[model samples]
Structure formats: C-alpha cells, structure tokens
Target: MQALIDQIEASLASRLYFLSIFTSLSLPDIAGALSSDNGEASSKKFIAWYEDWVRPRFRENVVSQSPPHIGQYIKELANPFDGESCYRFRCSLLHQGSTQHPKSKFDRIIFIEPGATTNVIHYGQINGALCIDLPGFCSEVLQGARAWLAAHEVHENVQRNLSRFAQRHSGGLAPYIVGVPVIG
Candidate 1:
C-alpha cells in the first residue's frame, strides 16, 4: 500500500513537472500525429495524452478485459468512466481549459466547478448542475490510482517486501516459522 502511494505520488509529481500548466504536445490523441520512430513532438499533457493512449494501452497492458471498460476496472486513470465521455471531457479540458462537456452524458459523468478554494465539495441543486471542486477531482483520481495499485499488486508487493526483508536482515521476520514439526 505504501509502495503504491509512493508510486502515485511520484507519478503526480511527474505529471506536474511534465504538464499541468502548459502542454508539451503540439497535437494530441488524434490520428497521424505519431511517428513511432523517435521521441520528437512527444506529448506531456496528461488529459489529452491519456485520452489518446489509454484505450489502446488498456487493451494491450492489462492481462484481462473482463469488464471491458477500462474505467470500470481502473477508475483512477479516468474517473466517472473510462469511455468516450471521459475522453470528451479530456478533449474539452485540452481545447477549452475546462472540463465542461457539451453533451449531457459528459456533464453528468463529471461535474467541474472552475473556481473553488477547497479540494473538493459536493454542491446540491434543485434545478441546476452539481458543482464539484476541480482540485478535489484531481485528488479523487489519485485516490483511485492508489486503489488500483493496491487491488492489483498488493500481494506481489508484500511478497517482494518479505523477500527483501529476509535478504536484508538475517533471522528477521521473513521466512516466518509457525510451529515445531512432529516426527512422523
């Protein structure tokens, strides 16, 4: 869990440094913009780049496609959905500097409040759109990523930590002994 958290934190830092404000990409997530030969004209924007790359990567990266929708499986990558709607949201953000999706589905998927102090706040309304703190949305995505990491790799991480502990310190907690064996 700690490992996953740390990884997520690092990923966030990378996200900020590489993107967050100005996009490094000239063109994003569209056809015929990639060379596959070198790193020239590479993208550093998360939303746009993620929109372009996530689907194919989801198909090729994961072992199984049980739920089929990557968002259903990995909510951290794109919240509220891992489908076209979220992609549209990304498009809106990239092109419009806001997560306002013109379509009702996209609007319902994620409600973004442009200016807010707190990280997150759920605004209730009788006949208007629900307002959500944008910062909170980012935090929620991080939380989802952490959850994803834990769900997928907790056991493997534990095993790796145990092995490392055993190797690092002689007669440590690793290779734990349960009880004495009786002679047969």
Candidate 2:
C-alpha cells in the first residue's frame, strides 16, 4: 500500500512537470514585451498583438464547451462512525482571469469537496442553502479553502523563483513564462 501511494505521488509529480512545461510554452508571446526598455509602450504593443493574434486562438483551443453551471454529486458510503449513510462530492474548475495584463496571468485548476451532512449532525449548507447539522463542517470547509489558496500561493512562489532564475541565466532577456510554470 505504501509503495502504491508512492507510485501514485510520483506519477502525479511527473504529470505536473509536463503540464507545467506545456503551459509555459503555450503562454502568449506578450511576456517578451514586458522586458523591453520602454516597458509602457511595449506593453501596449504586446496587448494589441495578443488581442489580435493570440486571444482568438486561445479561445478556440483552450476554452471548454461546457456551459457555465454549478453542480453537485453525492456518493453513498458506509459511515465509519456508525454504519450510516455517507455522501461525498468532488468539485473542480478550469478558471480564467479577465485582467488587463499583457499576458493573461491567469489559468488554474481548482478542486473542492462539498461539505458532508449526516442524519444526526447536519452540515451547515449545501450550495448556499442552509442545513443545520455538523457545526464543525463549516470549519472544515474553511480549512479546505485555506489549503487550496495556500497551494496557489506556493505555486506562484515557485513560478516567481523560476522566473528569477531564468532572468539571471538569460541576462534579463528571458520571458517570464518561457520554461517556467504558469501559476496564476
């Protein structure tokens, strides 16, 4: 079991590595303009270029076909505490940003699990509607959200570190996203 877990972790690491690489390469070319001496002018030019050249391509290639909607699913399971019914739902999203940055410093995968409720103890809420069991469930959900946000922060740090390394190695000519993870 330990070996299996280790293998799964290794596989996930490898996938993340490749995904980072692919994402780096797929990032728009506007990053190059950010390093120019006349950054303001270059930034404008890059934004124009990206709007004209890259945005349409990205919309075509990357955006999903699914309609924007919220959903939930429950799984029936035997409760460990007392042979009772249990349910779990996994949530995720392919999020994007809508800022004015030359290169869209945005794109991420977010994962979440719906708060669980039991017969005796109710979970606080499901999708904003109120429920009145398991008072601690809300706290657990908050913790999960904090953990996800922290993971994002750590990922951003890694990208920033890699950007610095690349800049140093390339004598300041390197683009931020080239060969670096896109964490935003």
Candidate 3:
C-alpha cells in the first residue's frame, strides 16, 4: 500500500511538473502576440493569445469540477491528434466532453488575458459552429487576456528557461495546430 501511495505521489508530481513547464512556455507566446503592435489591432491576435492561455485553465477547471484524480485520468486518456499541441488541450476537453459548457448559445467567453481588447467567439446553434466576432464580448475577453499577461510578465526569465528546456525535449512536446472543428 505504501509503495502504491509513493508511486501515485511521484506520478502526480511528474504530471504537475510537466503541466507547469508547459503552461509557463505558453504564457509568453500568448503574451507576446497580445503585446505585439500588430496584435493590438487585430482580432486574430486574441485567438493566438488564448491558444496558449486556455489549457491550464481548463485543466484546473477539470480538476476542480471532477474527482481528485480526474485530471490525471483525462491526461492519460487524451488522444493526441496529429499536429495538436498542449495548447489545444483545453479546447479538446470541451470537444471531448471532459469539460462541459453551459447550454446557452454562447457558453462562456473567457479572456485569459485581462486589459486586452475583447474578442468573442460566438457559438451558433443553427450550424453548431463557433463564429469568432470582434465586436461583441470578445472585446472583453481580449482585455482580460491583456491584464493576465501583464500580471505574469515578471516571469519572463522563467519562460526563457522553459523554452530552452522545450527545445531540448522537443520530441515529447505536442505540436500546436490551429483549426476549427467542422460541425456537421
């Protein structure tokens, strides 16, 4: 029993370590795009920002909403689709039913980065498609993303170290692919 407990602890530690590293690397990439001059003026920039920021948030949500070991279980059960990265893990959770969204037409639009412009992703029931609109609540989401980015900027060096580590262990890292799911 003791050995089993130890093994569980070790495994949890390992997963958390990987998650931390992954989330750390993601923050900068998202932040960079949000802070970039061109990003400031474009709605597409918000998508790039959330591509990284949403994963850990979703993981935490899963852990909180589900059982104690649910996160680990989901991580183990996750099927790595070709070209999908850790960043897309959160989005996958939604699509895979591991994470549930509200039944409303637009579930929740989270602006992971605060103080940035809001860019909304609209989900229409007619086509069951996600339509990203720049004029609505999306503006709030962008603003929130910017705020989150500003709060975490002090960890820039941590991001650099994580990047170096990523380069060294690139094989184990997931690839980030951007694509909308086709709702048929």
Candidate 4:
C-alpha cells in the first residue's frame, strides 16, 4: 500500500496529472476492501472507509459552504464529494472514461492543474460543479490512506487482505521464478 502511495506521489510530482488522478481514485476502493470482512470491494465499504478517512482532510468550512440553490432555511451544504458522489465519479472515470455523472450533485468534476507559483486552487464548487487542485487532492487521499494503513497495520483482517493486494516483488516470487523482479 505504501509503495502504491509512493508511486502516486511520484506521479503527481512528475506532473502526470491524469495518471495520478486515475490511480488516486482507486485507492479508496482498495482501502475499503481491505477493511472489510470478506475483503471484497463494495459501495458500502468504500463509502464508510472514505467517510472515516479521506473526508476529514478537507476543511470543514469549505465542505460546509452552502450552495446558492438552497433556501435561506438551510444552514449548510452537503459535501460536494461525499462518499457516494466520489464513488459515482470513480465509476464514471474508471468505467466510462468521463467525469460526468447523472446521479452526481454536480454536473461534472474538474481538477485544476497546479500553478507555477505558490497560489493554488485546491477545492470548491463552481456553477454546480466541483473543482479540485489535482496535486492537492491526490496528496490528501494519499495522506488519508497512509494514516489508515498506520492505524490498521497490525490488524489481522487487513494483513490478511493485504497479502492478496497487488504489489511488486523486488525478487521474483518463490515457487515460480526467483532472482528477477516481478509485479503481481
């Protein structure tokens, strides 16, 4: 998991925004599956995992800012990318190769590339759409995943599931090949 996180970080640092986004979107699924009893990916697990970990990283004020459409009676906005919305986005991007989701609160999601200077656009809603800083989003997800991993590193279930997680072996896996690097 750490290796995968490192790879995502490297991809972001290298300015491979699309690749970083593609891989970053999938981390929640992996973490969610690992935290489950059966180690199978499901919407429930994904949402719960995301809510527990990644959601907290975003600032409360930003996440709570109400949209214009809400009546004055409404006090706060629904998080633009609550677990369900994020899952919708993940499906759209990974399965459909698009950012548009019919069920999503936003018409679409946009990721802003990092600026050359210190100024950066990190997160917000714009005209019924969500805009996130590409690097910042990926980094936050990685941080959340890292924290979850540290907290659960010794858990029997996570350890068991992690055994099945895809990873690269510095040396070839035993009983098949040895002495050469392999990814499986």
Which prediction has the highest lDDT against the true structure? 4
Runs with alpha carbons beyond 4 Å of true place in candidate 2:
1-13, 17-42, 62-184
Error of 1 at 130 (Å): 4.1
TM-scores, all models, native as reference:
0.32, 0.20, 0.28, 0.85
lDDT by residue for model 3 over 26-133, one digit each (tens)?
343445443554332232443455544432343444455687765557663211111123234334333452222343233332222222446433222224333322
Lowest lDDT block of 10, candidate 2: 82-91
Cα lDDT of model 1 by residue, 2-114, tens digit: 44335445644564522422131222322112222222223333344444443334333232544567435654332333435445555666687764677735343334443
lDDT of 4 by residue, 14-71 (tens): 9889899999989999998898889999988878887888876665434445454643
Which is better, 2 or 3, measured by TM-score? 3
Model 3, residue 149: C-alpha shift (Å): 3.0
Worst 10 residues of 4 by lDDT: 70-79
How many backbone overlaps does candidate 1 show?
Answer: 1
Candidate 4 residues lying further than 4 Å off, grouped into runs, are 60-79, 116-119
Tens-place lDDT per residue, model 2, 42-73, is: 33443443343332332332223333441112
Q: Candidate 2: lDDT of 180?
A: 43
Q: Candidate 3: TM-score?
A: 0.28
